[model samples]
Every structure is written in C-alpha cells, then in structure tokens.
Target chain A: MSTVEHTDRGPLSREEMAAVVARDIPDGSYVNLGIGQPTTVAAHLRPGSGVVLHTENGMLGMGPVVTGDDADPDLTNAGKQPVSELPGASYFHHADSFAMMRGGHLDVCVLGAYQVSASGDLANWHTGAPDAIPAVGGAMDLATGAKDVLVMMTLFAKDGSPKLVPACTYPLTGVGCVSRVYTEVALFDVSGDDVVVLETWGESVAELVDRLQLRIARATRPRGPGRLR
Target chain B: MSRTQFHTAAGGTTAAEAADAALSASGVASGMTVLVGGFGMAGMPVALVDALIRHGADELTVVSNNAGNGDTGLAALLAAGRVRKVICSFPRQSDSWVFDGLYRAGRLELEVVPQGTLAERMRAAGAGIGGFFCPTGAGTLLAEGKETRVIDGREHVLEMPLRGDVALIGAHRADRAGNLVYRKTARNFGPVMATAAATTVVQVGGVVEVGALDPEAVVTPAIYVDHVVDLRSTSGEEHAA
Candidate 1:
C-alpha cells in the first residue's frame, strides 16, 4: 500500500488469470480448486510441481480431467465429473476427506466468488433468490478451513456493478476468510486490514478505486504465508 | 448358496420387489430413518433403493450426500412418495428434477447440513461421542441458532450425532464374514454409514470365501455389517481391480 503503481495493458484472458493463480501456488501445496473456473488452474500448473489436488469427494492425489473412453464412473472429482488419479492417489470415506479441510491440513483453496467484502468476507454459495434451489457443497468448509482462501472471479457483474464491495450484500459463505483475490482486471491482497492492489491489467489502480468507491493502495509487495510473502 | 450370498437379487415380480422383500425381512418399518450411501451415483445402492420404492414405506426420513439424480434410484423412491424428509449436504444437482419439483410443490422437507458436519455427525454417533465443536459453519445462516463457543481464537459450533434405523450401502466385494471392500471413490459414506445405523445391509458386486479376501484390504470389517445382498450377476467385473 504505497505509490500509484498503475498499468494500461489489456485485461488478462481467462487462461491468463488462471496462469497467474498457478504461478502463485507454491510447489508441494495441498490445494482444493472449486468446481468451475477454479478448476482451470490445474491445466496451468507446472509439470511435476508436486501440488497435490484434494477433491472433496474423497481423494488427495487427484490428476487431470478424463472424458469419453478414459472416464471411469467410480473415479470423479468433487464436481462429480470424471477425473484421473495420480501415482500416489489414495481414497478414503467422506468424513476423512472433509476432515482434511476442517482440520486445517490444506495449504490453499482457490474458489470462485460472487462478492467479497473489504474485510475479506465471502458470499459465493447463494444469491438468496427465493425461487432458486440452494446447494452449499464444500464451499463453507474450504473457506473456513484452508490456510489461504484465494478467490478467482470477474471484477464486475454482467450488469456492471462491482463485485468487490465495502460489505457484501449477498448471503455470506464465510466471514473474514479470503486472503487474496485474482480478477481478470487486477490482483488484490485482502489478507490484512487494507485491500492492497498487487498489480493491475487493462485498468489502473486509480480507475478501479474510483469505480469501486473504496480506498485501495498499490502494494509494495505481496504478503501471505506462501512464497509471494 | 453361501451364507454371504444368502439373500440374492432373485425370485420376485421385479428387481424392486425383490429388493423390497430384503428390506422388509430386515425389519425396515415405515416412519424410520434410513441412511442412503453415495456421492452422486458412485456408491449408490440402486437395487436397494429401487426396492424401497416397492416396499412402500411412506413417511420415511433419508440422509445422504445428494437427494436424487434423474428418475432412477433415489429419485424413483422420492417420486413414489416414500420419503417424507431429506437430510443431505447437496440436494440440488444438475439432474435432481424430482427433488426440485417436490420441494417447490411443498411435498418434501429438507435440512441442509454442511458436508463435513454431516459426516462428522454420523461418525460421532458411531463412536459414542455425544457432541463436538467445529468451525465449519460459524457466522453463516446455517449456524444461526446453534450453540457456539470460542475455542482457542476461533469460534466453533456444537454438532450432535446423527444415527439411522437402517443403512443401505454398495461395495465392490465382501467375504463370507461380511468384510467389505469398495472400488475407488465409491467408498465414500459407506464406512461411516455402516457404523451409524442400527442394521446395516450391503449390496456387493460378489462374495468371496472366508479366506479369499486379503485381511489388510477389508475397509469395513464384518462387525459393522448385518446383512449382505449378493448382486454378482449384474455387477460386472469392470470395477474389479
């Protein structure tokens, strides 16, 4: 949180955003990537990185997604989609799988979010729509359990409202759990008291601050319990 | 017939009826709580649930990971108006039309528990623990009225054990002693559900002789199992390793 470190480059594509998250994840970390876009991080991980994937269903050494001929109905990810298992993969019951999460055995968990409060509260599970059927899978457990909760999402809604807000309007999934946020437009560090702009793309810190209507400073350096720290 | 294959999926009007007869013989009465094992269709006991439909045990309570997927297994039972309530972690999946429709129409009751808490509740029940505190759902709507205390620096909520009248689980193989071994991820919920229920009935791919199974590989020891339904005819060897 210091000078106006600005940028005018184009916005990062979905793959680029995923790559940024991949680059940040340290090797040998036990991580859980949320079902959707967060799953893309797997493709960008380095070969032999030793970053073991933790599927909430009941596995530790999960590998790439498998489809068609290679897909086995018995081996699937938390999303219930077919996936491969690495050499060291092991399976257990549901309780033990979740125990890894609740017991704080996970190093990092990257998730997709609808809204993240300035104080790092997350609300991605439900929109509170009366007609919608609610499903709260492992989202709450990961948010509360991971050593670092990183969110990957678009900076703005389709209607152009900002997703990063002073306080979340939607129902919260977890309170003060998010440590960092990676968006297509910028990377933010919310682990501390202030929301620090680590870097920006397609938009400058000045424009983001104005549009977001919140106080943000250019990060002197990334801070967390990981390699970036 | 071997003792392990005592109740085979044979002799009935339909597989559902035969399965229902097994359920009936095991004292599965109406208005009881049943824990249905699976995480989607992986470890789901389809034959057993199809029997529950023919068993006609209305006003029954069911606990599982997902509610239903399509109009088969759990969905068929739910559509038959057998389940009065569903206690699950994630009920609304891509193919959960039966549950979605019934829920919207006010014909079903639902209690959504966090996946970790749901499993731990059952594990606690089997282990003889009354209740324990954890920090999975603190400060969320799910933990609204629950009792809470600050453990160390984090807030933890008290959760109680969840027992069942009966448990229906699927496994890859079992020995004559009723020792069970599962295939891959299908093992989810089966081991814990086995211990948390009063009478645990298992449907297996095949039954081996007493000494046929490797002693080190028995995931659910025979102590937790009460009945075995051999489905070796239909459970192809594709899942066997």
Candidate 2:
C-alpha cells in the first residue's frame, strides 16, 4: 500500500516557500509573471539565470522591482508597477506581446489561484456571485497557451477553507491547466487520483491535516493521468 | 416581409474600390460610432482611414485597442478633430496632441479595461456572451463604481461587452468574396472586431479568387465581412488607397 509520511517542522515561512519555488524554475526560461504573489518571484530569481520576463503591455526582458530611489517612472510592468529593465530589454507594440503569448513562444507562466483541483483545474477568475465585477484578463489565454503553468497560493483561505478541493465551484479559467502548486504548507503535484503532497514543510500528513482541519487520504499507488476526480 | 435594398458593385473591381463602395453604401455620416481594428501600427486600415479622413467625417466615437502613435493611423482621426470619444484599453502616448488634449481636459470619454479582458469582451460580444467576471482589477482604482460581489468570500470584478456600428479592419490579403487573412502582429484585434461590429470593412494588400485561399488560411471568414477595399501604393508611399 502507498503510505503517507510526515516531516519534523510544522509549516514553512513565506520566504522559505518562495525560495523553494524559485529553485524549481529552470534557468533561461521565458516567463510571464501574473499579478500579486507571482510578481514577487521576479525578485527571487537566482543570479546569472537568464529568465526573460514578458509583460502583456509589450515589454520583454524586465528586471526586478526597483527600490530606494532608482525606480524609473517610465519603466513599469503590465500592472503599471515600477520596475527596472534587464540588459537587452526592448519594447514593441502590445500586439506583438499577445502574439508571443498566443504563438506558443512563452515557456512558463506563474499565476495566483483561488482554487486548484486535484485534476489540475484552475478557478481564479470568478466565484459566480451576482454582483461580482468580471475581469477575465489574459488568464484564459495564459492558462491555455503557456507551455507550463504553476500556481502560487496559500493552503487555506483566511476563513480557514481549503483552496485545494475535490471540485472548484468558481468559474474556471482553463480546464486541467495546473502543473504544480506551491503553498505555505506543502508543495503539491496535481496527480490523477488526488493532490499528491510531494514535499511537506516539516509536518506529517495527519498533523498538517489536523492543523489545517481538513480531510486527507493516503493512496497506495501513483494515480495515472486523467484519473483525478 | 419588408426588405432593405442592397446594391452590388461590378465584379473585378479592385479591392480598394470595393472597400470604398461598401463604406459609401453603408451611408456613413457625421457623428457616428466606428470601431477600428489593429494593435498600434500593425494591420491598420490605412486606406479606409485615409478615405474617411479625406471625406471630412467628424464627431466620431472610435472604439479601438490602442489609439495609434501620433501623426498616423487612428491618431490621424484624432488629429483632424474627427473623433469625439475613444473607448479603448490604452490610448495615451507622450506627444499625441489629440489624446493629450482630450484626456487632460476630460473631453475624451475613456473606458479603460484590462488588455486581456478587453480582448475577451470583444470576443464575447462576437461570441454572443453577454458578460463575464474576473478578479484581475479587484481592490484597485479600476474597481471603483463597478458592481462587486463576493463569491465564496472572495471578490471578483465584473465587466460588460461592447459592440460598434462599424468596424474598420486591416488585412494582409483578401478574396474577392471577402475572406480575410492577416499577418503576424496585425492579427491581434482584427479577427475579434470583425465579428462584433455591425459593419466590417476590410482593407487588404492583395485580393484573389474566393476559393484560391486555403480553407485553413481564412482568418476572418466572408460571413463576418461586409465589404472589401484594395490598397494602392503611390509616390513611393504605400497608402491603403
């Protein structure tokens, strides 16, 4: 039977999780940083790594966020946040940006998520509320077009609800699009049968479940693709 | 059933002539809303734009993705004071006189949407989906005055779709029957606006027989197209003439 194992520490700090996630990204990737926590990944990229950053507003080769007094108002990310330019950076028409995205030129895209299902379905667009302001930005295209997708989010909502669930009730951006997920509690791979907890932040399965007050099951074998519920 | 009268131009008309005939047939007048397709300098309906400007049209609302950089493209319309309002994603450039003057004076009624959402909204308008929701601009100034709702305790932003009476599109090639194909960056807003507008006019570099184009190469099918115009290059200056 497949057994679930536990680790010594409880939960990892946010910094630890960021570093761990950053380590997995390959060097020389063409990556699009989604808004929010994914934007922070730019600051954590290892030195000498040649990751090309793309903004939907037509800039490629963006540097990390500038601090102190070095920030240039003219240089900003898609979100209009001030940023520095990396060497060999260039700007083009916004049309060219989407062309790069739609043409399968991007290597990876990291995004924030509200929910990620065991089957790798992502629901970050809307919760389907009556008065909700809909802003389904390039997420649909990014979720479908990028070569690989990684989601960064907390293990649970502020109200203590699990963000990982059997099914997503929110409006999904793309079907079965997530490749991996990084959370403060664990690094998980969206396996076919269930969310396989690959690396725990020093906590046992039972203890982690208890602390988060959720139900978790151990699988005896690796679930094949398309077996996710 | 009552029917609207239609006129047909002689076959073998140049693409530019065909486009002019179609636009003229639409009875376009002053003070109309027209949506233009193209992203920045790529795939713009240079011929149709020139004709409209030369025809002395005025007080128009232009729905576009970006108001072109000054001195050419849609900026020409703004420069001529022909445009009354611009509903677009982003229309600002440092030295664009029309955009700067109207924006600073609040004379331009701008509806700013996220780039992706704007594309999808145009797509949704074309696809007949009324509205959709997303969280892209939640908690920012973009959230102001928008209807907000909480789903599962998380907030999302809502946006509505838009459609225009006339859509001016640029294409790399077209068939006599009006099937359109656009090259690289020019394809951005062309295909989407092609479907969402009531009248879609195409300007093309080359026009061929209907079936001569491969089935897969037809980016915007003829059903969405209402007219075709040919581009003419003159004086070592290529104008969508």
Candidate 3:
C-alpha cells in the first residue's frame, strides 16, 4: 500500500473513515470501542469475522444497537445506550469486567482524543474547563491495558488548530500508549517523538507537515525494478 | 474451616413487614455508610430505598456506580436531603441533576472513582483481601497521594478495599433459603456488594420454594444474604395453601 499522497486528494467522510478502521481489524480480536465516535465502529464490523465486542459495563460479545422489542433495558453499554447481546454472550460483575480490561486481556481499544503528542501521550478526558464535571470513566485503564491503542478523532478542532501536537496541553491519560491514529484527514503511525505519515487526504505532504506544526517522517517508497540501492 | 452458615428466615406478615425488619436491623443511622447496587437504573432496590427514605435517617454516605438518575430510586433519597456524601464513578450523567444541584450548593460531597477501580475495590472487600495494586490509574490524578510501585516495569497504584454498614441489592428471584439469581445485566454489582457489607438486604421480584432453583444457577449464595423482601408476594398466598 502507498503510504503517502504527494498530490492533494482531500479528506474522507465519517462513514468512510469508520470503514477504514473497521477494515484494519483482524479476525478473532477482542476489541473495546470507546464511547461517542468510536462506538460507531460496532456497526461496521465485518460479518462472521469472529471479532468479540466488549463493553466496560460488564458485557462481552456485545451486539449492535437494537430497537423496540429486541432492546433490553438491563443490557445497556457504559454509555447507557440500549444494545443487544449476541449468541454466546456472557455477563459478569463489574470488577471482573474491569479485570478483563486492566489485566491486558483486550487486544485493541479505539478511543476518541482531544490531543495526542508525537511521543504518544494521550489527553482526551478533560480540557481543564473550570465548570466541566471532569468524569474520567475507563479511558485511563483502556489506554494503558489494551495491547494496541488506536485513537479515532478529527484531524483538527473546530477552531482549525492541530490535534496532533508537539505535546498534549490537557491532563495526560497514559504515556506512550497510542501507536496508531485514524482521523478524517489521514492515518498516522506514531512512535517515539515522530509521526510517520502512512496515508494522506485533501492535503499534500508539505501542506500536512506545515499544518501539523510538528515533524512528519515520511516512509520512503521502494525503488523501481533493476534500480540500485 | 467450615463454609459460611446461612442466617435469616422467610417469616414475615407482609413484604413491607419484612422490609421494616431488615431496615431496622441494618442499624441505619445518621452518618452511616451504605453500599447500593445498580448500573444506571438496573439492579436498583427501589422499594428498599423507599423504605429507607421513610426511615428518616439523615447524613448518609452512599457508595454505588452512579449517583442518581431522573429523580427516582437513589435519586429520590438524595432529593430527600438524606445523603451527605456519594462515593461513585460517574456522578454527573445527564439524568443525575439532583446530585449536581446538591454538589454545587456545597450540601453533598462527591468523591469520584474510576469505574474499574471502584469495582475492584468493592470486590477486594468481599473477597477478604486487604488491598491490591492496580494499573488502572497509575499516572492520573486518581493516583495522587496514593502508594505507587512499578511491577514488571509498569506503574501500579495501591487501592484499599471498600466496605459499608449495609448493602441493598436487587435480585430477580430468591428461594426461601436466600439463594439469589439476578436478571441479565441487572446483576452488574449485586453479587460483589452483597459479600462486602456487614449486612445485605435484598429486594427480589419473586420468591420460590427451596430446591426450586437449579443448584448450578445460584449467583449470590444464601450465606451473603441477610434478609429478603419479596415484591410480588405481598399477599403470601403463593407460599400458603
């Protein structure tokens, strides 16, 4: 796959972005989709993929949203949205469910972020607003416990500032936890103090570099056949 | 060396009579700590909380998952000016305005815990554990002033077990022996809380005879339950004739 776009091709829609993340999920993975935008990934999972969906509210093998007679009031997610239980689904107490999370049993956790440092520091829970209630539910545990921490968010804030920052300004969730980021503008493979541009949309490499206000490490393309190193 | 023995009988004139006996024996007084089981509205003991409201105790400390929602159940108790503090995970969901109002007014104290950490602390209390180290809130504000150590090169924080004077829980069915089974996800925190408190009182949907429940299906065994108030059997005809 080409990891760079030299020309400006534009941004992907929300549905397309969700589908892109869904396509990357491997079969037989246990994943926790965070509240808000990350929850949308549940509807896009490939059929019969053997991927188990887990909710932090003591449910594993959770199904997509249900309505009417199929909805069970007692079977809701952490977000308090009504959901259905798939076949082979199991329920446990709150502590055991959290053990499945903080004990490193989850394979992947997709979360929404307000800012992510180049070195993978995450800050999504609060913005330091004085009046905000500051409820940090399970974001910290999921970020640190999941094997692969994937962040899903928009590329920029509503005021047109970069979310991929030199360092997070808000309270940090976990240090060096995030490895990959899926945004509307592009997909990024982030490592120690560097963001590797794996894909681009609606912006050229140079433009993205300037917009991000941080260092962008471009993955070099392979040389043509018969060409020397 | 022997397993825990069961205490408490299915003898009362009415469901309300059973509830009154349980509430009185719970020794619920001003400034006592209570543990209630529920996630949002599910697994909440509505009638038991109502009886506590009528018991007229003030300055109570409540420990649960959420504070309250939409002015019912636990929220009603909070609205009645009976609660002085709340130890919970999510205290400000959309429907929990009762707590918000009291908290803003400096009447109710709010101590917010991480969801997983809260659950584990309660579990540790029930399992006879003193305390345990968890990796949930190592670098966050929740770890402030707490003991932290790195195990396996990862930071972990120590949290103490939480206990209460009384734990009020809801179950779908309970045999006269007090073996309880819950309905679906409503079983969220009921089983753990039942074992962690000094006394556990259950509000059940229905009552059944001994040996009616499958031996393998019992969730909270009879030893943990101190009393049961059957909501559906007020007339006592099912147990009689």
Whole-model Cα lDDT of every candidate shown, in order: 0.86, 0.68, 0.81
TM-score per model over all chains? 0.94, 0.54, 0.91
**Candidate 2's error at A167, in angstroms?**
33
After superposition, candidate 1 runs with Cα above 4 Å error? A1-8, A221-229, B1-5, B10-18, B234-241
**RMSD each, Å:** 2.6, 11.5, 4.6
Candidate 2, residues B93-139, lDDT tens digits: the string is 44456676666675666665656666666777888988766554555
Candidate order, lDDT descending: 1, 3, 2
lDDT of 2 at A86: 73
lDDT of 3: 0.81
- What proportion of the real contacts between chains A and B does each prediction keep? 0.77, 0.04, 0.58
The sequence of per-residue lDDT tens digits that candidate 1 reaches over residues B1-241 is 3333246544434334445656877688789999999889999998888777777788999999999999999999899999899999899988999999999999999998889889999999989999999898899988889999999999999999999999999888888988999988999999999999988888887777899989998899988887777775443332221
Q: Which candidate, 1 or 3, has the higher TM-score?
A: 1
Residues A1-229, model 1: lDDT tens digits: 4433336568889999999999999899999999899999999999988999999889999999999999988899989999998998999999998898989999999999999988999999888899877788889999999999999999999999999989999888999999899898878888788988887887777878888867886666334322443
Candidate 2 ranges beyond 4 A from true positions: A1-24, A27-30, A33-229, B1-20, B151-154, B232-241
lDDT of 3 by residue, B1-241 (tens): 2132222324445555566667877778888888998888778787788778888888999999889899888999999999998998878788889888888788888877888888888889988999998877677777889999999998899999999888988888888788989877788889989998988888887778889999799999988988777766545443210
